[model samples]
Target chain A: MKKEKLNIKAALTLATTALLGCHNLAQAEPTEKDSWEFDAAFLFYSEVDRVSAGEAIFNAKKTFEDEDVLNLKLTIDALTGASANGAVAQPTVQTFTRPSGNGQYQVEPGETPLDDTFHDTRVQLNGQWTQPVSSNLTASSGVHISKEYDYLSLGLNGNLAVDFDRKNSTFLLGFSYFQDTFTPEGGIPNPLISMLIGDRNAPTWDDDFAKTRLGSEDDKTTADILLGFTQVINRRMLMQFNYSYSTVDGYLNDPFKIVSIVDINGVTQDNIYESRPDSRVKQSLYAQSMYHFDNVVLDVSYRYMWDDWEIESHTIDSRFRIPMGDSLGKESYLQPHFRFYQQSAADFYRPFLLEENALPTFVSADYRIGEMAAFTVGLKYGMLVNDGNELAFRLEYYHQTPTDAGFEEPGVLNDVELYPTIDAVIVQVTYSF
Target chain B: MKTKFKLTLLVPLIVSATGCASLGVEPWERDLLAKDEMSLNASPVDSALDDHIYFSKEASSGGKSFGGGGCGCN
Candidate 1:
């Protein structure tokens, strides 16, 4: 057998010791009595002098004797800080018009331009229902709605799981749909238009700003499908595999993002709003494995993804949990986590546009889709309280570094840092009773 | 390129065709697997929170969860 095949077979042997503890309604049985469970969490995420966010989430579930369960979730979050505007570094300070047209933001020499007015609050509400269809089959459906200051989204999803081989293996199929709307501040800018309008003393939409308006709002829709299985390979191991495909249509561009137009001398001439294809299709494969040893547990997962935009990515995540022994009391443990991610730049991705070249139909300067690699290191501590209650604290650090595209840098561009590294810290606390 | 992409999709089929009869334990021997720590989702809330953070920071998302929770952070 080939090495890949051998590895798959070996992993299969380590599959679903977790079948007995399955909790996703795929293996739930009718409850003998009505019962309720609740969980809540708080999270804080901070990017070095960039953005900071705080979120609160609550989830509750109700189990009924009729072989059905109802689950509800609520999430509220607020974010504040500066965000990149897709402009490249320059040898001298630069001043650019903000999205509202009536204001301006300045960037220091050799620094990426950022819009300092980025801030928003969002709320999401969700409901889910699951029912056992037969002795070995379960079905579930859910709906969710989210609202932000400038964006709104509504979605629905359904899933079905069936078991076979004396409950040792299960197959799952699911589908989801989402409809979203964008109502950006000061309306949406026309794609590829020079968004720079010089400094204006008046606080009103000037003629230059009016000429750049495309519309007041735009709409987007997405359809996604997933197929996968979970298998119990042995008493000590569990494994899962999944394949997903999705198609998205309509308004895929960021209204606030722009690309710098530069001359051969590497001097920025103007900043123009970016454009992107209206439709996209993507496919991905994922695998996960969990194993329990004499005293520790190991969990690992990997994902491979590709898209019509020519972007491809690979991600690996792993965690090892070790008990704290009698020193920390019962049910106390420390878990260490490591994650690595890498992605190729989109087909039309460019750090900046060249004034001597023709404009492409689709183009963007967003670094998120650019060639990059990111990694995370984290640790978590969990302790049992009052026998049935639990408390957990987790701290993590994330860093991402973008690479230069294979483009010729001219004049002053050679010395500038076209790709800046992004760094962030994450902290979370959770409780269950 | 398309053919190469299709190869990754064969992983599930290969896994499903492997030996199964002796893979798992009997129903009565599920004591260890039945523990709370062995649950498929040991911590649902933590998983969700991690997903949220990664989704907001990365360009690629979606494997174990649904799609279409759009945000305006861009």
Candidate 2:
């Protein structure tokens, strides 16, 4: 039986090679056709009063004749700091359950609520290969895996492109699928359950705390499809358009987030885990254009997106690159970028629930699903050396704001700000050869 | 919603139809466009890092590459 299995595997491998093999392999010499390239970058990202992260990435690629290529990449990230727990601030000290639902903590009066137990490291690896099936057709495939302290993700993707109109235009189709597993440190908490703490006045611990499992895991899956077109409109201009659709299912809730419950007078009552729909379908249309002039180039793109969760968004990105005088026989350029984004809230998003209203089937306080807008401004400088090496640096400032959802205001807490502004900065350096 | 869907379908057709006007230049004029600096993604590594950052902080993703999904943070 083992011999038969081995034979079957061999046959399958042979068949796959034959199907994807180069049509003109005999015309190319391996040593003459292959060239190596490498890129490395370090990133620092920080947000006010929230998580901060530092990351580094290294990528290596080998290019063969006809633009065929193989790539390998490694990424590492370290994250630390505090994140909001979606609870409201009040005049009295407030206590809430921890993520594990087994421990509790307190926030001082008139202070924003935050959970400081956020620290983790992540590592991700990716591999991809591209090959030309013919002079006008190409195929590419890739796989990636990422691991964190409480999460794991594995995914695969493939793309096909065909050139026509003398290579002035191309059509592309791509598909991707991913599977993810999550095992929160304290296990997944039941949605909308009042945080358990020892008897109210005695500050005793709940007996059920010991029963919470630390090894439970939840799974999520996502599938995506994209159709794209690229055209060279003029010698100095190019344009591209793409339409993409994606669907996600299973365990869509954030295990660490919770919502505050308020009484008729806006007095804080309890805090419970947030809940959300288990599935979502989303679609987007994107268009991009690039134009070059005597001393500069312009790049611009726009995207419109909507989803079944009743959220809609628009994004615009624009950049201008200006060439500077040559330095030491190397070309140098400076680029400035501006980006804008706005999004509507999801149907189930709320700042806080009222005890007088009917219990909601789905509810969440996660600010990401709330109405918001963000703007980014950045500058980058790059240089190309005589030996074909490249070096670049970028600095950016980002600001995000949350807006009202146009819902009825709570009678007593109408003055409270449900969302706080977030300000962040990013710095990056990249080198390639 | 239906009208938005229709517009999404129509915009692409209109853009492609305009191509029939033959507004493109001859092959020799492509010299400038052939330069690496003129490409849409001149810095692939930098673009990848930017994409990752936006995905983690925002509610929407995609338009460039694919396959990486939600992190535990989301």
Give me the runs in candidate 1 sitting further than 4 Å from their true place.
A1-33, A202-205, B1-17
Whole-model Cα lDDT per candidate? 0.83, 0.81
lDDT of 1 at A30: 25
Per-residue lDDT tens digits of candidate 1, residues A157-256?
9999999887888999999998899998889999999885665865554776888998889988989999989988888888889999989899989898
Per-residue accuracy of model 2 over A250-355 as CA lDDT, tens digit each: 8888888888889877778888778899999889999999999887999999999899999999999988998876852368888899999999999999988987
Query: Against the true chain A, what TM-score does chain A of candidate 1 give?
Result: 0.91
User: Interface RMSD of every candidate?
Assistant: 1.5, 1.7
In model 1, chain B matches the true chain B with a TM-score of: 0.63
- Lowest lDDT block of 10, candidate 2 chain B: B64-73
Identify the candidate with maximal lDDT: 1
Off by over 4 Å in 2: A1-33, A199-206, A210-215, A327-329, B1-16, B23-26, B67-70
